[model samples]
Target: MAAVPLRRPLDAETVVVPVGQVFVIPERCKGCRFCIEFCPEQVLVESDRMNAKGYRYPVVADGKERACVNCGFCRLICPEFAIYTEEIR
Candidate 1:
């Protein structure tokens, strides 16, 4: 018997990765990890600096400036509304 592939490769022309910039209100963040934990792109991480409330907020991980896809998943999931994205263009 021959093995069957589960999927075929997509053609190069059809692939378009979205990009955006991520923003955060450090003071509005309460150290909750929802945005960081649930980001589909996994583009965020806890920063070394703490806000006035002593809560570590999310920042774009090093070398990940172009990694955000502008999906708004972080904005949708953030209870504190501290995280959002805007199209790069």
Candidate 2:
């Protein structure tokens, strides 16, 4: 059997990937689908939860916790102002 080598990042110590802390007001979301549809990273997905308005909200996709880039696109695009992101410094 051929052995597969595990490759690691050469500059893992110095390279910093910006992470975004995503926040969503579940009750404020009216199933607008802006955040889930327009994320440049495509990190948001449809959540199986329903809020007070009986509408599905956006949630981070499985295994994509660190995918957001803190671009503020979701907040800007959301008409309900239900979602926002803060950059993790």
Candidate 3:
């Protein structure tokens, strides 16, 4: 007699979704909060450190760095073109 194999159930909560990669050019940023305010995922925040121009720049928030959804709102809202996102693929 042959034995049957057992399978475990899949859980939706355990699935991991792919997010976008976010890049920030601190030197080009002018301490503007447009990116932070317009980000759909709210993944960016003002960094504690200042840039070369003595301006606070946006960075991936702690514990939420991988939350970006590849949305270009941050890039579009950035008047200085300091921030952008790439799809994770």
RMSD of each: 2.8, 4.8, 9.8
User: Which regions of candidate 2 are displaced past 4 Å?
Assistant: 1-16
Overlapping backbone residue pairs in candidate 1 total 0
How accurate locally is residue 3 in candidate 3, as Cα lDDT from 0 to 100? 82
> How far off is model 3, as Cα RMSD?
9.8
Model 1 — TM-score against the truth?
0.84
Candidate 1, overall lDDT? 0.90
Over 9-85, each residue of candidate 1 has an lDDT whose tens digit, in order, gives: 67757867779999898999998899888888889999999999999999999998899989999989899989899
C-alpha lDDT values of all predictions? 0.90, 0.91, 0.86
Candidate 2 has its poorest 10 consecutive residues by lDDT at 12-21
| Steric clashes per prediction | 0, 0, 0
Off by over 4 Å in 3: 1-18
Question: What is the full ranking by lDDT, best candidate first?
Answer: 2, 1, 3
Task: Compose the digit string of candidate 2's lDDT tens values, residues 1-89.
Answer: 98889888999999777899999988888997978988999999988989887899999999989899899999999999899999996
Tens digits of lDDT, candidate 3, 1-89: 78877765577578565688989999999987988887778899999999988999999999887788886888888999898899885
Per-residue lDDT value at 78 in model 3: 92
